[model samples]
Target chain A: EAGVVQSPRYKIIEKKQPVAFWCNPISGHNTLYWYLQNLGQGPELLIRYENEEAVDDSQLPKDRFSAERLKGVDSTLKIQPAELGDSAVYLCASSRTGIKEQFFGPGTRLTVL
Target chain B: AQSVTQLDSHVSVSEGTPVLLRCNYSSSYSPSLFWYVQHPNKGLQLLLKYTSAATLVKGINGFEAEFKKSETSFHLTKPSAHMSDAAEYFCVVSPSSGNTGKLIFGQGTTLQVKP
Candidate 1:
């Protein structure tokens, strides 16, 4: 089975510009998650979606970040007026319902300069 | 709330030697623990997981981990090191309560294998 898939493996944008990343979870999976990984650190959760409902998004920077998993299949994460600190790798993952083990995508490396 | 700590930032092992990466976790209740490996420029891959089952869990690529409740530790180990085993390893924990599936990850341990 194909693992999670993400688009624009690498992105470069100027500070204050808006940037977006896309993710497509594995087939038959009902739980999806977004994570951010800074250099030399482990990934930090951003948001989680159970089907189309965002069950947990406490870590998301609401002022500048927004995410949606419409139709319960694909998802998108957007950042407006990106700042230099926003430069990091964005990872997407998915798993079967009630399963904690996740399959991750290659990730989108965003560079805000 | 749950958290994980990788005791070592980096470890070096000679090819054919044993490998060990230490991890400790804090949780209010029984937790699901996992080991994930990430090769440079690649995404995280599951090495193995312990979910209140066997304390000794064997994973892919000849890696394994032992979950010790008394010590609150889950340390990854490999019988013998291989050059290809050089990568960053992360320890993770998730609540075993309602099965939310939200994970807390450790900083990470970088393994270096010498020829």
Candidate 2:
């Protein structure tokens, strides 16, 4: 079976510009997660969706970051007026409900100048 | 509270030699541990997992890890390291109680394989 799919493996944008990343989870997976990985560090969870409901978003920066998983299949993470500090890899992962193992995507590397 | 710490930021080993990467974890309850490997620009792949079943968990690519509750450690080891084993390895933990399946990852260890 194919793994999780993410679009635009790489993106570059100037500071203060809006950016968006998309993700499609593995088939039959009911849990989706968005994580931010900074250089020389492990990935930190930004948001998590159980089907179409976002159950965990405490780590997400609501002032500039927003995410949605409509139809419970695909997800989109958006950053409005992104800053240079926002430059990092945005990773998407999926897992079966109640499963502890998560499958990760290749991730989108965003470079903000 | 749950957290993980990788003992090494980088480890160098010659090809065909043994490889070891250390990891330590802290959790309020019995935790599910995992080892994940990530190649350059590639997604994270599951190398092995310990879910309270067997203390010795074997994974792909000749990798294996032993979970030691007494030491709060789950260290990855390989009898013979190959060039392809060079990558970033992360140690992760998920608390068993109130388990939302949230994974806590370590800083990661970069393995360098020498010829």
Instruction: Give the number of the best model, judged by DockQ.
Output: 1
Clashing pairs in model 2, backbone N/Cα/C closer than 3 A: none
Off by over 4 Å in 1: none
Global local distance difference test of model 2: 0.96
lDDT of residue A54 for candidate 1: 98
TM-score per candidate: 0.99, 0.99
Q: What is every candidate's C-alpha DockQ against the true complex, given to 2 decimals?
A: 0.93, 0.87
In model 2, where do residues sit more than 4 Å from their true spots? none
Worst 10 residues of 2 chain B by lDDT: B95-104
Residues A18-90, model 1: lDDT tens digits: 9999999999999999999999999999999999999999999999999999899999999998999999999
- Deviation in angstroms for A38 in model 2? 0.3
